[model samples]
Target: MDKRSLTQLTERFRESEKRTEILRQELAAAIRQAAADDVPQKDICEATGYTRQQIRRIVLAGETETAAQP
Candidate 1:
């Protein structure tokens, strides 16, 4: 309701958006690196601090990309 509160909320939202973008880029790079290196999902997970399931999903997505290429 107050101007100060509104400003704080806007700042927090901006920070969250920036963090999300950084994480997205990091995830994409990790996926690409994993695909290029032919690393195992578990190793990717360990290196990237992602869970096994997340690593699997990323690797599978990379596989689909490779499959789609001519």
Candidate 2:
């Protein structure tokens, strides 16, 4: 491939990677919030546009926040 084409492809790949990372972080945050709020995985999936398996995985990864003491 030409240098210009190669550069374009690299940039596209980088952009996609960045987007994926952002989504992953967002999903993690959503899962944590859902857990903190006692929301079900199904509800979190609906709210966050993530699949059930993705939400389950995020929850299973132990992203829950501890309850704050008064």
Q: What is the C-alpha RMSD of each candidate to the true structure, in Å?
A: 3.1, 4.7
Q: How well is each residue in 1-28 modelled by candidate 2, as lDDT tens digits?
A: 9999999999999999999999887768
Error in Å for residue 26 of model 1: 2.6
- List clashing residue pairs in candidate 2: none
lDDT leader: 1
Candidate 1 worst ten-residue window by lDDT:
26-35
Cα TM-score per model: 0.56, 0.61
Which residue pairs collide, candidate 1? none
Candidate 1 per-residue lDDT over residues 1-70, each given as its tens digit? 9999999999999999999999996787777786688887767777778788777777678778879999
lDDT of all predictions = 0.81, 0.79
lDDT of 1 at 42: 67
Identify the candidate with maximal TM-score: 2
Residue 4 lDDT in candidate 2: 100
